[model samples]
Target chain A: MKEHATKAAAFIQDEARTNWHDESLWFVRSKRDKAAHGIPEWEQLRELASQIKDHTLSHLDEYLEAFEAKAKENGVTVHWAADAAEHNRIVHSILQEHNARRIVKSKSMLTEECGLNEYLEEQDMEVIDTDLGERIIQLKEEPPSHIVMPAIHLKKEEVGELFHQKLQTKKGATDPQYLTEAARQHLRQSFLQADAAITGVNFAIAETGGVVVCTNEGNADMGTHLAPLQIHCMGIEKILPKAEHLGVFTRLLARSATGQPSTIFTSHHHKAKEGGAMHIVIVDNGRTTQLGRPDFRNSLKCIRCGACMNTCPIYRRSGGHSYDSTVPGPIGSILTPGIDLKKYSGLPFASTLCGSCSDVCPVKIDIHEQLYKWRQIIAEEGHLPTAKKQSMVMAGKVLSRPGWYKMAGKSARWVTRWLPRPLIYNPLNTWGKARELPEAPKESFQEWYRKNRSAS
Target chain B: MSKAHILKAIQAAKPVPCPLPVVPVFEAETPPTREIFGSVAAQSGSRVVRAEDFVGLATAVRTIYPKDISIATPLRAIQSDIDLQQASPADLNGVDVAVIPAQLGVAENGAVWVTEADCVHRVLPFIAQHLVLVLPEDRIVRNMHEAYAQIKIDDTGFGVFIAGPSKTADIEQSLVIGAQGARSLTIILI
Candidate 1:
């Protein structure tokens, strides 16, 4: 995978688009603040959510069995997949059993992580993403940029252009309403004809053997309710002990995501509708491994609200696609490292260590702290870039010895003053390329302190 | 075999037990009002209409949508172009408006509790271009906590808390009223 910084540089090449993306996410962050402030027990609710997740994750084995048994009693077929490949095979086999050639699906990052679409296409099944944003990116043949808003990085004109090419919409039409209406009319046909629908579970109630899927577009419900067969794909971490827990999460989810009171639709599916078959695929896919890591397992507490992404300075500017992970931003940085430490080592360094992401997070994942921890692990495991490792090692040696450090500091100031512009701002100096180095001080802090304090 | 392997991994890696925190109860200071419901619903791109009874709902829905539009309903008095009971979920794709009953309404978010029993097809409320819900005025609750306390999940196989019209701000964070579901939502409060 390409380093995040390399991809971010490409994303930031268009200066205007970067600013638009940043400001747009910041606007959502502000709306989240307003929605959160309106509720007096917002912080308490967040803490409760965190605690509930902690409790459930601690007893995951028991709850998983409980949830599966209950779902089976409700006449739902529950399947377990050890990995992404197995998950894809199971879903494809189910579709094959029903002779389903065409399928409509809502936004499920789990499907993206599993590469389900590609797997299904190879099996000669057509998968149409029904969420408008998801559809926009899918038509463009790209992964979703943001978890909540899939096509958030794209401009209206780009979407209009994409629609022109794919859907044959009127040329030069960029209005979201007009574009959305076109998508609706187009996807409506897919929904009506598709043999099955698949959705992502927001929360799986262990008590009732049911699942809740929240969506602003109501795309999940529309597709699932229309199709003859419905399937919900959920990671093992999505379970909650009781149905009453919906009150806490439902209030926090949309408000933290897009800053609404709630998503337009929070559909609870207890069983399959009349004659339809409802299936639940609970996939492990490295989650069990993640739970084993004491420091990073809290990462599983994420509700996929995208609050961390909205609040992340680097993510807002660099764009979500830069991380090169299914779920991007701070959460992805923590998550991706555990799954593939060598490939995603650069992700942890992509942040400013601002801790804003943690504060804004509904489940309160210590994102910046985990990023710091990952950096140390990456360095220790020799996963860090060679240049970074070498420089850090050299700096560590110099900083360890006081006399050498002072001499080095003095030489650094001397070199900055005497060296030519081209010599000082070379390719090796990564910080100097985009920004100028700070002017060398007349005296080091030690020198100034010694002179002032000794005489007094 | 996969289940056992996965569960074994989880059991081995599991952290020490942390008890679930006591959920705090949030009491709304202000009583539920029709105005609060209307404004909150409006914030989510849904309109709230006050009607005296079922007969008035027909007039209200007609005023908002043209007569040529295909209106579907499970309600008795509302004049509808399509009978939802007779139409399959997929067949209701072209429906312009669907009038359904809501079990209760929450004032804080303008969410209305809708169950499968209230809908002829589970997709009726979502598939329509526009939706109208007839909720009794007295059924409005203060917040979601109250609504959940009153909800019986076992009785209905399916249910949803619909807050507003289907929406998305995905494209450059521009607010789009309609995405894949109903373009608009109208709640007829009687």
Candidate 2:
């Protein structure tokens, strides 16, 4: 896969679209601020939520066992998948047991991570994504750019064109309401016809053996309630110790995600419905390995709220597809390195280290700090790009020696000021590609400081 | 095999023990007043009506949908086209309107708690074209914290906190109501 910068360069080619994407995400960030400001205990909620997740993760094994036992007692068949392939296989086996051919799934990023749809397609079972945002990307054969707003990268005109081609809507129609209705009518039929439904878990309460799935469109409910067989996929890190923790998370989630006080529906399922079978697939898929890293373990605290993505300056500008991971943006940068360092080594550098993401995170995952930490680990593991490695090594050597550093600094300042633009900002200068080089002054800061303040 | 592998990994990776913290108690003001709840629910894309009695709720429902062909309700006093007891969940696919009773209401987000016992079919509240949730005036709570305290998860296999009609902003950040579920929500406060 191409590096994040390469994809981001291509994505930002259209200045108008880039600005629209940036502003669109900023609008959500401002809404989040407003929502957060509305609650008197918002900071308290963040702290408490962080604490709860921290405690649960410390005792993750106990909670997972408790959650599994309770869920089994509630008549749910709980399956644990150590990886994505096992998860896919477990879901397929369930469908095969039920003789279910048509599958309707709501927004489950875990399933997307597992490549469940592709796996099912290979197995000759028809799969339909029911979430409006998910359905748009599913039709386009693209991965979701934004977690909450999956189709945020596409313009209405593009969506209209895609719908016109796929659903045969009016060729020139760009109205969201009209296009949404077309999806509604089309997916409703699939919901009715689907023999099985699959959804993602938002919170799995270990104490009560229940899973909560929140959605604004109620697609998860519509699909699961209609289908006789239901499968819910959850990462192991999703477990919470108690149901009361939901009050804290539910309050913060939608507010952080899209500024809604709450999602339209927070459906709690403790057991399989009457005469129907339910399956819960607990997926590890690098979570346990992530948990072992003390510095990076906090990344598991993410509730997948996508607040970090919205608040990230780089993410808003570069777009989600730039990261080229199942989850993207700041959280993905810190996470993907743990999963596959070599393949995703460039992701850690795709940030400005603004710390906006950490400030906005509901669970208070120190996202920016983790991103910085990942960069160091990537370099140590010999996974960094050659240019970055060479530059860092050269800079390190120069900075460690005071005499050489001063000489190099003075020489660089002289070179920057006297050298021609072509000579100074050539192929080796990656920083000057999208930005102008700063004007160098005649005297260095150290020189001026000594002259002014050394005797004072 | 994956289950054992995962559990073993989790056990081995377990961190230093940290006891679960007690959830901080939030002592806010009382739940929203009838007027406040009405406005909040309205902002969430739902119509809220102060219905003094069952008859008043029926009147509001009729006013909301004057010419609808089919209406399903579990309420005994309210007359409707389909009785939830007799209708299959799949059969409620295109129901024009459904008047179901909500167990409780959360004022913070204008969400009403509805359990499976209240909804005859698990799909009744969602499959209906327009959903009318009849919430009693006394059942409203100040926030989700209080709402969670009062409800019992084990009492029902399925339950939901429905704040408004189904909605989405997926198509270029436009708020489009009724994406794949109820197009409108009417909370008739009794």
Candidate 3:
């Protein structure tokens, strides 16, 4: 896989698109700020949410067992998968048992990580993504650019064209309302004919043995209710100890995600529909490994609100696809490296270490701090690029020796004063490519300080 | 076996236990009222109608929706074109409007709590093109904390907090109401 820098460079080639993407995300960030400011006890809410998640992660095994036992009492089947391959196999077997061919699914990042769509399609089963953004990207044959707004990267004109070709919508109609209507009519048919429905769990309450799915478009509810068979896929960390925790999380989730007071539909499922089957699959793909890393375990507290992505300067400018992970943002940068350090080592370096992501995070995961920590680990593991390693080595040497540092500083000042622009600003100087160095000072700050102090 | 493996791994990797923080109710200086609920509902793109009784609610519903539209409901006062008791989930696809009773209303976010018992068919609220929720004005709560305290989530197989009409901004962040579910929501408070 291409590293983040190379992919980000290609993404930023279109200056207009880059600026538009950055501003669009900034708008969402601003909306989040407004909503958060309106709440009188926002900080207290964040603290409570963070503490709740920390407690749950520490006692995850007990909660999972309790959740399973309660779900069984509720007449819901529970399944567990140790890894991605096992998750895919377990879901397939469930489908096979029911002989379900046509499947409708709501947004589940876990399934994306497990490549469930490709796995089921290989078996000649028809799987349809029901979320509007997800369906758009599925038809366009691309991964989601944003988790909450999956098609945020694409323009309406592009979406209109895609729908025109696939759904037979009116040609050249770029109106979102018109295009959305066409998709609604098209997906309604899929929902009615679907033999089974799949949804992602937003929060699973062990107290009541229910799973909650929140959505603004109601796709999750539409699919799960219409189909005879229902399945919910969740990472084990999604478990909450009690149902009242929903009050804290539900208040924070939509406001943090899109600045809405609440999602249009926050549905809780305790049991299967009358005469229908309900199954919950608890999958631990790499979460246990992450839990082992004390530095990154807090990342599991993420509610998948995408607040970090919206507020991140690097994420806004570089775009989500540049990270090349199931989740692509500040949180993804910290979490993905744990999954495959060698392949995702460059992701941590994509950040500017701006604390906006951490501040915006409802659960208050120290996202930027975790990114910094991952960089240190990457360097120690020898996963850093040769150029970065060499530069850091040279910097370390020059800084440790005062004599060498002074000599280097003098020569650098001399060179900048005398050398031509072409010589100093060459292709080899990556930092100088987009910036111009300030004029060399008459003397170094140390020399100026020493002389002035002595004179005083 | 997979469950045991996952549990063992979690046991080994999980951190030291931390005490769960007690979630507290955030009380407003002045408690939210039905007026606040109506305003908040309007902000989220839902139409709010205040009615004195069931007869006024029926009149408001008739005035708002077209006469030829197919309506589905379990309400005794409101005449529904489609009988939810007899209609299957798929049979309710053509419903133009669905009027259902909400157990309670949240004043802070303009959300209404509805369970399967209220809709009869689980898909009625979403499958219909428009949704009309009949909430009693006296049943409004101040916030989510108060809302959860009042309702038993496990009382029914399925329940939802319907805040507004189903909407999406996926197409270039353009706000478009009515994406695969109801296009508009009208809250009739009786």
Which prediction has the highest lDDT against the true structure? 3
Clashing pairs in 3: none
Which model is ahead, 2 or 3, in terms of lDDT? 3
Model 3 docking tier (incorrect/acceptable/medium/high): high
lDDT of 2 by residue, B88-132 (tens): 788897689998999888878889999999988999999999999
lDDT by residue for model 1 over A304-400, one digit each (tens)? 9999999999999999999999999999999999999999999999999999999999988889999999999999999988898899999999999
Query: Model 3: residues >4 Å from true position, as ranges?
Result: B53-55
Candidates, DockQ: 0.82, 0.86, 0.91
Evaluate model 1 with DockQ and give the value: 0.82
Global Cα lDDT for candidate 2: 0.91
Local accuracy of candidate 3 as per-residue lDDT tens digits, B1-190 = 9999999999999999999988787878777688999999999999998876435877888888966378888999889898777889999999999999999999888899999999999999999999999998889988898888889999999999999999999888889999988999999988
lDDT of each: 0.90, 0.91, 0.93
Error of 3 at A219 (Å): 0.6
RMSD of each: 1.4, 1.4, 1.1
Give the number of the best model, judged by TM-score: 3
| lDDT score for residue A431 of model 3 | 89
